[model samples]
Target chain A: MEEVWVTGAGMTRIGRRSEPLPELMAEAALAALAMAGLERPEAIVVAAMNPEEFVGDGNFASNVASHMGFADVPTLRVETATSSGAAAFYTGFAEVASGLCSTVLVVGGEKMTHIATPRVSELIGRSIDPYERSYGATMPALAALITRALMARHGVGEREIAAVAVKNHAHAARNPLAHFPTPVSMDEVMASRMVSDPLRLLHCCPISDGAAAVVLSDTRGPVRVAGVGQGTDTLALRHRHDLTSFRATQTAARAAFTMAGFGPARVDFAELHDAFAPFELIALEDIGLVPPGKSGTITLDGETALDGRLPINPSGGLKARGHPLAATGLAQIVECVWQLVGRAEGRQLNARVALAHSIGGLATNNWVTLLEASR
Target chain B: MIPTTVAGIGEIVSYTTLHSAPEGFRSPLHIALVQLQGGARFVCHGAQTRRVRIGSLVAIEAVDNIYYFSSLNALDRARLFWGRAGRAGDRVNAMTRSVVRRLFKGGESGPN
Candidate 1:
């Protein structure tokens, strides 16, 4: 395989927006291409978790490519539910790495704020196992069940879980592109309305409308795609042996580390999928960045904060960064690129190697991608 | 595959009371993940979430293609039997037929 480098990364401000899905994606696409100093890529990999349901558009790859004025480019759509963006990135990475294409553009986005909250929940909930969904298990419901199990098994407290949201929101306050870019206190997060038992509204990422894009090429660039790995598990949550940790994430992290030729200790900072706040702590342990059962204590102790020893979610994470389903995975990668290149303005941290983790449906599909500044 | 069912008690592994339910579902929906005594596990709806504790045993009932779980009183078990036996037989039969058809078509084995 040939070497792959991230030439450029761009993303729109996440949250409710008036633009259509294609337009939002085009904006990010254009920005990324401009940053890469390229008119268009040899191939385009588009990702939208449920554009047919969320935006009433099918044949998304062709739709997005043409809309972005790359009408003749080879295009395809890649999806793994909520982690569609990262899946698209992997496709683009393969296209460049395998010499299928010299350059590729990977873009992902979602539009859901246009729908009612219940309807949005219903649509997103479609990702859940049908039997579980029939039991009225929405995303938060399933996450709550996991959170409860995590608490029971690890003695993780409500305060510890709530701290994830607090720290991310504080970090988001420094991020102009964040959805909830205002600081939220522990008292406020703890007092937030309960969406699902043991998981409050603050713990949940909002239904957002946004897009993110990245340009990849075999040519040397500022940031090298050090490693990328994907992992999948049984869709039904009941089939898994352990509820506290995600096997998919572990598998992906293992592959990523193997490719990077190093262990987790070398990662300077990370952008974690905190779609639900507890996931941050869970991802930390699953990726071997933190010792098992120590994530909660260190997180609550401010070790994962922006100025801490190992900053997590310097992009505000999916929590405050806004989780626009498919857009989230690419956004996380874009944030890593920004931080590595010293573009993450106020929330910038001293970093070189960065890792981005994304989860699809209920931790069933996960991806871990590592990046390093090409000095 | 042959059609079959598991009837027994299971412990609630974890549960949640959902305040903002999906469309066509009522708010404050109580859902639980249960691991049966025989080791089979599934998600089930609950009538009440109050007093429900993790590791507490609850009986499972199949009615209208959905599983309902709770700590049952004698009256509750009788009501479940009556509902499953005849009260909703026609509708349950229709759903069961669809489920069997889906299974034959290489779909999910369990009813949605």
Candidate 2:
């Protein structure tokens, strides 16, 4: 198999948009093509979850391909809930690495703002077991429970969680495409309305409508996909022995690091799945980037800031970048690619390698990808 | 209404904890895959119980917002007592002792 490099990347401004899903996806695809200096792609992979429910349309991949003028190219869809973006990128990478295609375009898009908030909550809750849903165990409820457990077990507090939101929002202030670009104070985060006990409204990623795209080629470039790993666990959280960590994420990260021939100590930066504020801390531990209970110290010390030693979520993460479900994972990859190639603009960090981590459905499925700069 | 029939129901599958559950929910909640008669499955929460055994055919009952299925129903009690006509009368005898204890504790003394 050959190595795969990200030659181009683009994302639509993540916010509530009146534009249709296909149009938003097309815009991102065109932007990526322009960035890559290519007019077409050999293969296309679209990542969208439940477009039927969210946009009243199916065959979303073909629709997007048609809109982007890739009508005759081989196209397919990939869906793994919030990790759909990463999953699609993995597929595209495989296509290029296996010599099936020289270049592949991976696009992840979602139209979540069209639905009502309650309906969105209901749809997201469906990812949980029906029995859990009956007991009112929504995603926020689970995250809240996990947050409380982490706090009690690891001595993490609301202040640490608030620090994550504050830093991400501040970083987003320089990102023109971010939905929530306004920096928030820790006090504002603490005072935000509670969605589920420990998790407040500001702690959760917004219901966003947007798209992100990346072009991958066999030609080596400034940034290359050094490693990719994905793993899954039981969807029902009750079956797991531990609640404080995601076993799937740990396993995926371990495999990714092994494949990349590097460990956390060698990594310069990371983009973690911060669907909820507390998740960043949990993910740091799971991914072996931080010690078991010391992630709180990192957050409290502002180590995750854009200018910190090991900056995290310089694209503002889901907390500020606006998580459009399937699009979030690909967006993380785009951010890492930008940073690795010195194209992150305002939020660029002095880093040569970065890791993008994404979790699907409460960490049941996890995908970790490593991006390294070519010497 | 979809008029979906209740198929073969299974016991509680699995569940998780909601430590930060609003006001009421706090304990490690139990969730199950209730298999309906028509092969359709629905996820549900199990009622508060000391123990939940697999393959235990529990009767489903609803009260207000919650649903429960347990072996402590009238039909189960009758099957344990009157239906077991011969060999193992010891199980009935033990149940009788429990009823006596309940009566002594000023609780309802009925078989169910």
Candidate 3:
């Protein structure tokens, strides 16, 4: 396998926006192109979760490339629900690793703010299993179910869950491009309206329109791709061996760390997918950043803060960073790159190795990626 | 993978009260994953009981081709007088009434 480097990282401000998908993607792509100082990419890989549902368009990869003014470059699109962005990273990595293309541009974005909340909820619910769909299981509802189980098993409570929101909000307060940057108190999070049982509005991430892009080249930059791995499980949570643990994420993290020849204990930082507040702690455990069922109180202890030991989600994560579905994975990668390059600005942390993890359908498909500072 | 169904008793491992039920579905819905007596597990739309706790015994009740977990004890005990049979009897009575109404309407064909 050939080595691949993250040469450039760019993204538009993550929040509700009115621009079209192609335009948003083009903005991020041009930023990456300029940062990389390249005239053109050898190839392009676009990632989108559901453009057809969002904008009634199907050929999104070509549309994005056309908007980027690329003249007849080989391009393709990858979609694995929420994990599309990470999958696109792997796709570009493969293109370069297999000696097919030297420099590949990977861009992922989504336009979801304009859609109504209920419609958005309904559409997002489509990614779950059909059997589960029959029971009308939305993502947050399923997450709430998992939370109830975890709370019972681990003696966790709403106070610990609310602490996650408070901590991420504090991190987002210092991030210029974060969607929500105000510090939230645990009281506020608990008092917020309930979106699902045990999960308040503050506990959930806001729908946003955003795009993020990265340039993967054969040349090494400040940060290089260390390892990547993926895993899958049954779509329905009922089929999983345990509801409190995500086997897909655990498996992916193991594979990625094994390939990188290091364990989570050695990782300096992580950008985990925390679409819901409790998920921050849950994913920390799932990726082996912490031992099983032990992250409940660790979150309350301020260990995952920006300057704390093994700071997680310094970019505010999905909770405060805004969740654009497809763009989230790439945005996480962009944050890792920025941190590795000493460019995270207000949220900078002294780090050499960073990890990013994402999930597709309710723990059905998951990906783990590792990035290390080139020494 | 091979498919199998568990109609016997099971235990509720985890559960949630769904507030935002999908369109066309009723809200405040009760859903749980039950580990069947034989070790197989599946999701069950459960009866809206006063309280749902982990490790509660439930019986598989079928209605309109849908399976649901009905609490074996109405008051949190493994008593022989399980409430599931009463619900099943109620469902049977409702079906009987519907069938009688259809018969009184001169055998008009309709979905059961």
Candidate 4:
């Protein structure tokens, strides 16, 4: 198999935007193409969690490619719920590695701010199992369940969970493209109204509208896609063996590490999926970035900050960076690429190897991606 | 395909009180994952979580094809009877029947 490399990366500011979904996707795709110094790609891969409901559009691959001035390009769409962007990247990577396409354009985005908050919640809630949803289990509700279990099993305090948001918000303060660029105080986070018991509004990501894209090719580039792994679990949470940690994340990380031929020790920094604050700590442990039950301690010790011993979510993560559904998975990869190429500006960190983790549909589908700077 | 059924009694494994619910659901929704006597587990909606605790026994009642969980102890049932006036007797009767069915399903072994 041919090696895959990330040739270019680009993303729009993640927050409430007026631009339509296709326009946001085109902006990111065109910027990535310009950065790669290419006029077009051999194929295009598009990702949108639910444009059918969010933006009232379908046949998204063709729709996006046409809007981006790549009307004749071969294209397809990929969806794994919230991680649709990362799944698109995985598809593009496979296309390049298998010699099916010399160059692939991967773009993802979502526009949900135009809709009512409750309506958006209902659409996103469709990803949950029917049985669970029948009982009114929304995303935050399920996350709160997991957070409570983690707290009970690992002795992780609510303060530690809130700290994840604080650190990410601090990181976002330096990220011009972040949805919430203002750093929030711990007290503010603690006092934020609870969306679910034990999980405040501050602990959850906002409903943002944005897009991100990347250019992948078989040829040499500054950043190599060293490994890509995907893992999935049962849709119902009750079927899982443990609630504290996501088995899908652990499985994806193991596959990614094995493919890269390097363990977590070699990772200089990471962009973790922090859709909910506590998930950062849970993912840190699941990815083996820190020992089991130790992520909270390390995080509170300032070890997961931008300038910490092992910076996590230098892009502010889905927490402060704004999780724009399908846009988030690709945005995380874009952040990794920028950090590796020394273009992250204020939030940049000295790093050669990076990891990006994404969770889809309550961790029913998850992905792990490894990148290395060739320099 | 044969449809499987779940026991009407279980212990609360994990639960949450949601203040921001979906479009059709009411806010402050109390949802819980309950593991039944036969190890079959499922989610249940309920009125309140004030008396509910992890590992506490709950009786599951089906209303309009939707399942809800309530504390099954006698005192809790008595409190429910006294808490409301109209339809109090019907509610108590339903709760007692559910409790009896759960006990029979367990065959004296009770929830773990």
Which prediction has the highest lDDT against the true structure? 4
**Of candidates 3 and 1, the better by DockQ:** 1
Number of the predicted model whose DockQ against the real structure is largest: 4
Tens digits of lDDT, candidate 3, A185-277: 988999998777767889999998999999999987778888898989998777776777788888999889988898887799999888888
Distance from true position, residue A93, model 3, in Å?
Answer: 1.0
lDDT of 4 by residue, B67-94 (tens): 7788777876567668676555655565
Q: Which regions of candidate 4 are displaced past 4 Å?
A: B1-8, B72-112
The RMSD (Cα, Å) of candidate 4 is 6.3
lDDT of 1 by residue, A251-349 (tens): 999999998899999999999999899998899999999999899999999999999999999888999989999989999999999998999999888
How displaced is residue B20 in candidate 4, in Å? Answer: 2.2
User: For every model shown, what is its TM-score relative to the native structure?
Assistant: 0.90, 0.80, 0.90, 0.90
In terms of DockQ, which candidate is stronger, 1 or 2?
Answer: 1
DockQ order of candidates, top first? 4, 1, 3, 2
Q: Evaluate model 4: give its TM-score.
A: 0.90
True contacts kept of 3: 0.52
Please list the C-alpha lDDT of all candidates, in the order they appear: 0.88, 0.79, 0.83, 0.89
lDDT of 3 at A146: 81
Please provide, for model 4 over A1-375, each residue's C-alpha lDDT reduced to its tens digit, 9 standing for 90 to 100.
Answer: 899999999999999999989999999998898889889999999999999999999998899988988899999999999999989999999999999999999999999999999899999999999988877889999999888777765448888998999999999999999999999999999999989998999999999999999999888999999889998999999898678889889999999999999999999999999999999999999999998879988999999898899999999899999999999999999999999999999988999999999999999999999999999
Every model's DockQ, to 2 decimals? 0.32, 0.08, 0.23, 0.33
